[model samples]
Target: MEFVMETKNINKYFHKPKEFHVLKNISFGVKKGEFTSIMGKSGSGKSTLLYILSTMDTDYTGQLYLNNDLVTGKSQRELSRIRNKNIGFVFQFHYLLSEFSVLENVMLPAKKLGEKSPAEIERNAQQKLDMLHIGHLAHQRASRISGGEKQRVAIARALINDPTILMGDEPTGNLDSQNSENVFNIFKKLKEEQGLSLLVVTHDEDFAKRTDRIVQLEDGEIIAQ
Candidate 1:
């Protein structure tokens, strides 16, 4: 299997004359299509570590590479393109555009990646929504859908890019138990069917434990891998 992401001696810190370290010498590699979870208590650096891994925050020490390419020194324009094309992100909040319909929400990323005719984009968006079992909600305003439906649309949007890797910072954070499980099941399906790597930051131990591999972090350092 291909290595989806790798880091060596990666460290992150917040400095203000006095340095405050948040991530301390962490290293790990994730394989393609593998599901891995990073777990820790509050302020254990779990979220901080995830941000560095996902290419969202890059101001850190040590080598951080995505798909074997060193991500340092890339221009903002270059990085933005990379992010749009190769990686997909789902945050704690379903950042759906309220003004757009469900189909439009899923098409936003694809539109940014490359320009396509509206008809074509809609076709693609519908296919992705169908995959997530939310095609019926395609015409509804995002604000009108339930939280679970909104999250499913977010997942569909992420998948529309056909990203090599998907990163989740508590993707199911706001959902109830049933909805959370449904979202997680979608993640599993993506890994099995699309060979997509996943690195999710979750406080839910039950969810973390279900992943194929677990990386435990505490005090900014990786305690176990």
Candidate 2:
């Protein structure tokens, strides 16, 4: 089967206060349309591995491939372009621009990508918000929405670019159980109906259990899959 993203023999280290290895020979692949979760205790390098997989951290040794393209040694500019066109990320914190309207926040990435006309971008952004059931809040200030609504908005924003893969790092970590379930249901809906691939980092067991597969990490190495 083809994969949306793969990491082979990935290794990472930190030299800040002292040299410390974070990720060790991490390898995995996220299949097309598969919903997979990465789970590990705090400081297990789950987030560190995710940084490398997402192509945001280039200070790692590995063969990183996304959409069948080798991105391991790409320049920052090239990687940025590739990421804008291919990957969507949702963090534990919804990094929405508080001053912008929900619709604007969603349109930001699409606008930066510049692959579509402004009017087209607006239409696409609205469609994403509607798909997430937040179209009515599009004109509202991002700071004014509820936490759950904010996350949905964030997901909408992440989808605005029509990325090949959606990656989440503790996407529901800030939500209450009820809201977390809401977010999970949305993810499931997208995977089932839209056939979008997803790789999520989560500590919530129930959430991890619900995914198609679980990749567990311990001390920066994949311990189970």
Model 2: weakest 10-residue lDDT segment is 46-55
lDDT of 1 by residue, 150-172 (tens): 99998888877788888899988
Q: On a 0 to 100 scale, what is the lDDT of residue 66 in model 2?
A: 95
lDDT of 1 at 154: 89
- Tell me the RMSD of model 2 versus the true structure: 0.8
User: How good is model 2 by TM-score?
Assistant: 0.98
lDDT of each: 0.88, 0.93
Scored by Cα lDDT, where does model 1 land? Answer: 0.88
lDDT of 2 by residue, 1-225 (tens): 799999889999999999999999988899999999999999999888888888899998879999888999999999998998899999999999999999999999999999999999999999999988889998999999999999999999899988899999999999999999999999999899989999999999999999999999999889999
